[model samples]
Target: MTAICIKCGAKKSFPYNKCGECAFDPQLAREDLVKSVCLSSGRYGSQFEKEKYDDELNSYSAQLRSGLSVEYDQEEIERLDMQLTEVEELDDKPIFKYLLRVFLPGILLLLFLIGVLVVLKWR
Candidate 1:
């Protein structure tokens, strides 16, 4: 009987066996999950990048949780949950900070141009 591999969604001979498509083994799911979590938790260039990482982590957690016959370590899943929470917290920066960072340079340039115009007008 063929069953779907939870990690890669590929058809395998059995639910508990190693996946041929992605080489995902139920026996090593915990290690893979930890590795994925560690990889996802890193410095991101922008909010979009962080959000993408968050999505990847979420999908990985879901896949592990939905496995047909695989048993994941509860403590490991809890740790992943904590890491996901941290990632989410990092993603939720105040909009005011982002806006200021993006527009400060333009605002400064506009002020400098206006100052130059005012001085020229006086002359």
Candidate 2:
């Protein structure tokens, strides 16, 4: 039986609501998006690139919300959103930034004081 693919609005012999391009493959697309956004650690080389990525993500989210494509599953979209949030949170933190800023100086000061005390004891 021939039917229309709800995603691309194309007629096909397949019984599924989605065409081959939209055939329950949102996971792959989501993975690509996550990789692009997360792997960069929020360090977009330029403002334009960052805006482009953000626009792409927002468009995908909108498409999922609008149900324009049969492959646009709501549950998957929610999961992707959660993952993006996690990535953003991770990007907000720099490695050892807090430790360096808050503790390194204090530790150095303590070591210096201890060295001075040992020198005085040797006198």
TM-score of 2: 0.28
Q: Among these predicted structures, which one has the highest lDDT? A: 1
lDDT of 1 by residue, 54-74 (tens): 665455545655663345556
Q: What is the lDDT of residue 84 in candidate 1?
A: 55
Task: Write the residue-wise lDDT of candidate 2 on 24-79 in tens digits.
Answer: 42234545444323322143457677666555444544564466743444565566
Our model 1 lands, by Cα RMSD against the true structure, at 13.8
- CA error at residue 2 for candidate 2, angstroms: 25
Cα-lDDT of candidate 2: 0.51
What C-alpha lDDT do the candidate models reach, one value each?
Answer: 0.59, 0.51
RMSD of 2: 13.8
Any residue pairs clashing in model 1, and if so which?
none
In every candidate, how many clashes are there? 0, 0
